[model samples]
Target chain A: MGPAVKLKDLYFKYSIHTDRSFILQNINIELNRGEYVVIAGRNGSGKSTLLKIIDLIYPPERGDIYIFGNLINEKNIYEARKRIGLVFQNPDTQLITGTVVDELAFGLENAGLSPNKIKSIIEETVEITGIKSLIDRRTDELSGGEKQLVALASVLAMKPDILLLDEPFSMINVIYKERILKIIENFVRGGKTVVLVSHNLETALNEALNNSLMADRCIIMQSGRVEFDGTPASLFERKAEYIESLGLRAPIAVRISSEINKNIDRNFPICSDIKSLVKQLTGLKGKELKK
Target chain B: MKELIKIKDLSYSYNSQNDSRSIYFRNKEKSSVLNNSFALKGINMHIDRGEIVGIIGPSGAGKSTLLQHLNGLIMPQQGSIYIDGKSVIDEWDQKELKKFVGLLFQNPEDQIFEKFVGDEIAFAPLNFGFSIDDVRKSFKDFLEYFGYEYSFKDRLTYKLSGGEKRIVAFMSIIIYDPRVLVLDEPTASLDSENREKLIKLLEDWVSSDRAVVLVSHDMDEILRLCNRVYILNGGRVVSEGPTENLLFDEALLEDNGLDVPEIVRLYLMLKTSGFEKIKKFKTETDFINWIRELKNHA
Candidate 1:
């Protein structure tokens, strides 16, 4: 019915006793329903802190947060939290139960869903995430990547209106990473909201190009403030000097494209993948045409 | 080149404990464990002084298990390891082992414990019987090399950022000056600028009397830093060769779930698209130079 998340004049600091510097200062942002947003920054630049605040895990010292246009406060905090699901960078932190099935069922059980409904949701989540083989395996016995798949399934079983993933697949292997990205693709295509935080250049590029899951907005944070906010294309096209100064990086294809453009003094469009980049470089429409 | 470390017929597996009373022990699901067999299977590798070697593989391929064997953190179930001409299986003194090989695990939080940064870095060397004056001199040299100010010595280890913590972890290890340095995903948390700085620092380190064994998923780093590489899959060495040659094998790399570097991909795509003039270049600078030459010809 309204923007999925809205934060106004949010200000936060760890505590009054610690250094008085604000950890987050005068933040204002709004995400419409079905929008995909990426928050990128160097470590300790407050990317995780922003996600925590949005999930209401860390309360802002000042300002208002509205989820789906309803202001969040103690009176409605529990109800609001039910509508948001969070998956952390480390799957071990979020996985509670011993087996995958129980882990997926834990959240639904807490929400007081009927047993049958829980079972069906778990099945659907396993099918979507393609973690059917891992459904019965013990969480501790699973590898880092497998644990992340279980974590994603556990969160998706709730069917929350807003999904927040904090560096969700950085430690995962490529095979599981692609499957996880596929799940995210399906979720976003179904007109849901996602806010992903990461510094991984490869995943960002692949998700941007192959899936056409371009971020509606990209926000780069620095020293507890938004240094840059724009489209993903603009973020990748920023000068190397500036991006490096912010302690971030562009994908390798983008980097090569930039160098080629600089050498030729002609703006060859930035291609997120190598195939398209080669196409642009040779000025060929298709592979057959070149042959 | 004489081998500093030799791993022969190494194999390891996690045995399900008979005591299942622990909270983490799920006795019923023991058979369902994804990898019930050897985490590492009859692995063999060698590291020589002044060599930079990279070990890469997909997750669950026993990359970390292989690293743990080099420093005797975990003993080989079936084979032997030799460090500095001494068999690690027969000689299990970690204190003596630390003098020859310094291992930095993937997670810095697991390795760093002292409250202050200076205390954290100084703990190991002091324990190893370094005189106070020697420790002070080494710390000063590290400060100058890493470009850290004197005031940074007082900062708490836990309070530092992720990248800063990794750098400090590296400093803690390098202060000891082990002949062989084993680093697991050293650049995972570092920003690109810091990563570049680390590459240069590693290059300098490996050019001298020290050898470094790096384990990572970053193909670019492997291609840039490592002279030799071993590709592991399912706890076995799938391929091992010079970095340039092994990385160029697209089928081997992709089948192992490793991403081919984008520049290499561009070369292949151009060749596939019938651009006969495209040539393979090893590094970014060479690639850029070739591009400039192409522009000039055009």
Candidate 2:
């Protein structure tokens, strides 16, 4: 069994005001090893704050977060942070280097990787991301998605043990949106832990949600608390209204499949994939329940 | 209904490398968005007075490009647009054209110039030489309608949040009360509650016989507010119809660069999967009611 992430009633807040202000409260989630997870909710639901906490960009006010069986505290916080890579919501904020080539090598330099290996990693990253032509372009000129790819290329060069993304595709064009999803999916398949925070319920379900359906878990935050935390299937299997009531959109597939079950007036699992939903429908009609 | 605006085979193309390179549309080298291409082509669309029309398509579908033409922002290379039967693009003066149709760009930050919030909101009308008294009456009413306190007038415009910036952006046009308003991505970054309010404000504006054109990537918002939707792809109006068609046509939306509303997909799945064969819903509630009927009949 591989080491997994554990949260012990973790309390996270952005400000010092205890009684009035708290970004996240009473969050207890366990992300399994090498799992691809999505934490989704409305804006200000603490999705971004949680990822920032996991990424060690900010400290949790109360409770402990364990990554790979190691409790994150002051002692190991510096060492533990090396394992996490966060592709932030705003690309402009994360960018430190003036040029693309420097950005690709920035994290590796931070990790004290040798110069020879650094050159090889940068080449592989720029080539794989298809940003070789764009390496020389100024940061201000790149479009929304291109900037994100540059940001991602930099992170991948570091080769962190776990990855965290905060609305990584929010500003990009649709073409790059699909491309980043594929890139992130492939990155997860390589056996590195990945957790994402996004308000884009549709993409989360269609792209990463299914890949992490059974093995991985997601936490739905509401009013600064964990509303639902479980496998994707488990979350959709029973509760539909609880999510909808919170002004959060369920995965399109889940809602549609559920609607199918309702229209046909029969119960079935919410399947994100079209093929599986069709199969489920086929099986249901095979029985030919009296119409 | 008054014919607020009209376009007759409107066409426009920009030099990609040379944003300032071309004087005429025909001189542009590219026929399409192949590196440096056409932003719009043969766009023949119109909005009646008081019509709340929606423009939607995928990311690069030229929705914004078409909206820019409505207000005379980018002069067309080869086309004619008539506002109130007047050839606004071909003939009207710049100041007069701006008063009839105010075009609101997506990023409010791009539009902001004045330091104070009040100054920014009042800038457009002031530039049009509106009397100070009229601007005062209109600005106060507009701000109150959107649920903002009067004191916000004193604050710095740039310091406001994304949602607040959008409100200020809309107010800039509304203070002058343009008969035809065009807004791009009106609620792109707003939270759910604020988004609802913004929609309501837009709806009221449209209902006043002051035609409003909304260009949005969020199909759900358009489905709720717009009476008619024009689906633009590759610089042409490939599909234009009532909200029912745009919202229900999942294939048209997805292929054209939009994710279909969940209700539409559900209706589609049910239809294809041997449940029923209905293709439209005016709203989610309407769809829900229809589903319940489907179950009852089953």
Candidate 3:
């Protein structure tokens, strides 16, 4: 198959006459199947807008979009949307059912699945998302993080070929955040595509740096433009200035390794985790002692 | 120091008769789930003036529920909450208590209602009987202090991005000049620069008579800004102490489904590696400075 998604010279604005500038400008990106890409940028940099456009919620003012090698127009928009699942930033915006179980089943029911199939899919989804306990509870009673998880589960139940998440970890605790990331990793391993927009640059960068399976590429948006599109390592190593200019700090391990390397005037590989970085530092200390 | 806010054996549950039309009563079979469980159970905590107190836990651990009681958004079904030694339930009216304790909800869209940013910021003060001229002046001063252009006040509230909406919600509350500020995940969608600005602003805002109660999942912010911390789980206080003491305890934080801040984790690892002279630094800059000093000594 062709790229999972392709956007060429895409431009978008909420209002053409009232707004002065496009929310997304001249964006060209091709995301491959089984690739996990993270889009990072400062707030109001149009990261979320780009996700919305790709999910087919917003039509671009000027651009061409192709999904699975099929051009997206009015007639085929619904077909394209069926293959993509978007979990919005605000859980309240996406959740419409009265209860969690109903919410998970809503998408499957709409997809015209049999009752048995829908039940099985929801059971499988709840197990994967670890939300089995929440299946009977009302959706409105869920905490922000719980609601966010349910939103993801609802999307996952649809079994979309491409998954787009907007700041999925923004409200979740660290433990659940790690769990959901693993879920996303497994999804991509199944030959699916995942595009996650994250405000937590450190976590996203670390994911890309440490595990290519979790995130293969990183794209930084600035003022509605794709300023940096490369591997996470390249973004941290060659485009540190760009990351700094975005008012985002690099990952802790990357930052600490760079500082240590600068002070000792020695080149050391960038480490993504604290444990690895510590090991590197201790080895360096031992070498210096022997000298 | 005087206690600005105190909670004694405070508890709450959503299983009330009046809420039958709400989510708590939507399903009779699942009524025993979260509704029957106390959102907060006998929670005892206090915040002193001039202190930034942090409340952290996993999702649905009653952090937000506890915060709602401070501003009278939710009434305690079991215990008492005192603001300035006045009872929130019995003594002070809800509106009066809200004036003293301003709350910024987890979602900025919850608190923001006005069309324009200026109107949203000025809403509370105008309703509290402040003069229009004074409100306008305070709005201008707020913009300038935050390093925003004066024209930013003209932007529509709904048109603003998620982070910008958060700033406006914060401004609306701060403009009223409350004695205590309650924030829920205040830095959720904010970029680093804006997050830094907020940290600095909070540092400057607290005084001998003012305090802040912060609820967040971001341990780094809690470590940097809070003087004391409370860890809640299952609607109860699992641990409470000075921020450094509780935050550095990886076991305690991990037990509550929280992550130790990366800098603190690094510090502890270094300490175990025999960097005994190193102190616990809250900010990354401090950690780097210590590394530089170590290099110079070598």
Candidate 4:
């Protein structure tokens, strides 16, 4: 099969009367089946705009987009969107139902599924997302993080072929963050595509490095253009200053290991977590003791 | 140190008649589940002048509820709050208390309602009866301070990005010069550069008589900006201490649904690996300096 998603020379601007320049310009990207890609950049860099274009919420000013070997146009826009599920950056913007149960059922109902089918889908979804406790709660009463989880659960219940998440972890706590990452891992394991946009590259990099299945590609955007596109490991291999210059922070392990490499003039493997960094440093200490 | 705000046995529940009725109509099974629980339970805390006090916990831990009480948006049902040594419930009206304690809500769109950026920044000051000329002058100065062009004020508020909207909301509150600034997840959607700019702005804004109350899920920000932190779990203070001591407790942080800041984890790991001389450092630069010392000794 062709790539899960392909964008060619895409350009987008909010309004011709108000916007003087294109908010997203000359974008070219191809995502494959089961690929997990992270889009990282500063605010106003068109990260969310890019996601919107893929989800068919925003019509591009120019260029072509292909999903599952099919061109995206008005004739097939709804069909394309059915395969794509987008969880917006602000949970409030996407949550429209009065209760969590209804929220989860809205998409399935819209897709014309039977009540029995919707119930089974919701049961599986709530179990996967671990939001069963919130099934009957009022949406407005949920805290920001709980609302975020509910939004994710609602999207996951649809079982889209391509999942696009925009800053889903911004408001959630650490525990929920782990659960969300695990959900993403499981989804990708099912041979589906996942694209996540995050401002915190450190967390994304940590997950990508620690778990082999988390992120396969990392794309860095700046000023409405892709600046770097490579594996997360390769992204970290660049100078720490270069990453910081792009408004991204290097993972703590990568930063510490790079500093030590520069000081000792040795090529030590970059690590993504504290445990691995400690092991490398302890090995170095043992070598010094022997010398 | 002078205490700018104090809460005594403050408690709040969301069991209002209207709320109960709505819950009953919406979902009968869930109404009983929520009607009996308190949003905030017997919380006592204080914020001193020239300090940034942090409140952190998992979702629904009453962080926002507590912040709302700080500015009298929500009156305590069972206890009392004092601002500048004056009882919030007895001595001050909501408007007066709001001017003294400005709150920036979690969602910037909630706090921002004006059309233009300039108008939004000026709304609070103008409402407080400040001269229009002074407000305009201060607005220009604020733009210049933040390195924004004067024309930036003309941009439509709705057109601004998430980070820009947050900055506008922050400016709206600080324009009126509130004694206490309460920020709910100020850095939630901000990028690295904007986050640094906000940290510097907060450092520059606080003075001997001014203070801030910050609620965030970012442990790094909590460690860097706050002097004291209170970990609220289930609407009560489960742990409270100076930032350095409190944040380093990995077990406490994890139990409260928080991640240990990367630097803290690194420091502990290094110490356990027998780097005894390395001390706890707040910033990455300090850690780098310690690493340099170790290299030179080697």
| Candidate 4, superposed: residue stretches over 4 Å from native | A16-19, A207-213, A258-272, A283-291, B16-32
Please provide, for model 2 over B1-298, each residue's C-alpha lDDT reduced to its tens digit, 9 standing for 90 to 100. Answer: 4678888998876544433221222263442224426668888888987689998765555776677777778777898988888886557887899898888876677688899998888788888999888988888887787766887798677555555677788789878878888988776655444566678877776754678888876666777888898888767889999897668876677677676665565557666777565757756567556655645654
Query: Candidate 4's fnat?
Result: 0.53
Off by over 4 Å in 3: A16-19, A207-214, A259-272, A287-291, B16-36, B145-147, B272-278
lDDT of 1 at B40: 85
Model 2 clashing residue pairs (backbone): B32-B37, B58-B257
- Model 3 chain A worst lDDT window (10 residues): A205-214
TM-score per candidate: 0.90, 0.71, 0.94, 0.94
Q: Native-vs-model 2 lDDT? A: 0.71
lDDT of 3 by residue, A1-291 (tens): 589999999999987335578889999999999998999888889988899999999899999999999989889999889999999988988999878888988888888999888878877998899986677767877888999999999999998999999988878897778778888889899999999998668866654444444468888889999988988767767533457787676788877777666665467767657778778767766655566
Give the RMSD in angstroms, all C-alphas superposed, for model 2. Answer: 6.8
Each model's lDDT comes to 0.78, 0.71, 0.85, 0.85
Model 1 per-residue lDDT tens digits across residues A200-233: 5445655566556667878888888888988777
Candidate 4: clashing pairs of residues:
none
For candidate 3, chain B by itself scores a TM value of: 0.91
Distance from true position, residue A177, model 3, in Å?
A: 0.9
lDDT value, residue B50 of candidate 1 = 76
